[model samples]
Target: MLTCDHPFPLDQYDDRVKEHLRFTGFYHASQIGIVQCQKALVNALVERWHPNTHTFHLPIGECAVTLEDMAMILGLPTDGLPVTGITMSNFETLEAECLHQFEIAPRKSNYRGSGIKLTWLRDLKERLQLTDENNIQSIGQYSWGSACLAHLYRALCRASRFDCKEIDDPLTLLLVWAWIRLPYLAPVPREPRSFPLANM
Candidate 1:
């Protein structure tokens, strides 16, 4: 049983947490319903996911803020980062497609298309059962899960460079990334309208 309710500081770093989530099919790539973006998972992924190019901080013209800065703003863990974002190129992204799919099931829905559920995420313990995928599919509501999707989205951000306006706070910029990626659960340049954040 996990005890840390706050899920900050490093609770998510606990291997048990990752195992729990993964077993619950959190890492399962076929399930296609909405899952809860547990703070534990988000904090863990932010801490675990590789960094974007620029040494540590994201480049904004001449200024830059680092993962540590973003962690500080969000009150998350900032130590022991391992990011390949700086060199995350199209080739690497292409290479990782199969691995990514095996690790995470990309939502098969289009931007504002179908297969979105908004019902309350059931008990993680219950969902952990490895039976069928996308149990939330039957719920008919939109899935509000974001942590897994966010990790994938962040990967796309790293693999490609998008023209972003000057944003002062790294926290706000991170949130903007989340807002942009979360809505459609996608991060790509398939079309300008597909991603509104492109203009913002």
Candidate 2:
């Protein structure tokens, strides 16, 4: 799994953002390429989501517009968006909101070390299957997990610039969560471990 100790640097140039999104996990999965899907997603966002301000930096890197701002920009009603009680105060709240939306069970009390497993991947794929295939295919020929992760990473990356104030639709947020969180749980290695001769 990719280990990013810090949040992505949204203050950087567009090229830098593109590089991080595309090449960071380029070869991690065979189902689809990260770079290709990112471009497609960007295109969709550009076409569908209008920025509140006339300046690109204002909308893209400084602060995210709230759901109200989004509605104003898109000329849509805000009544349809669900208001999440969790705020972006910290990672825990963000994670909790995501877990709740995906219906991922909490960690067992008896759990010992790292809880990563194949079951997470299975559950993620199942959720993706419930989404529209056209939406899924727009990104790439990615598995449910890969597509979900890409979307989440992009959303968070976009959210980072906006002081974590963006209000997206609950369904949209759920989809992004599935993409971002699912890929982090890498498939468990199947090969057996070898023991040292000294142990025998």
lDDT of 2 by residue, 23-53 (tens): 3332222211111123233333333333444
Q: Each model's TM-score, in the order given?
A: 0.23, 0.21
Off by over 4 Å in 1: 1-61, 81-126, 129-200
User: How much does each candidate deviate from the true structure in C-alpha RMSD?
Assistant: 17.4, 18.9
> Which ranges of candidate 2 are over 4 A from the true structure?
1-35, 38-78, 87-104, 108-200
Candidate 1 lDDT (Cα, 0 to 1) = 0.32
State the C-alpha lDDT per candidate: 0.32, 0.33
Give the lDDT of residue 98 in candidate 2. 48
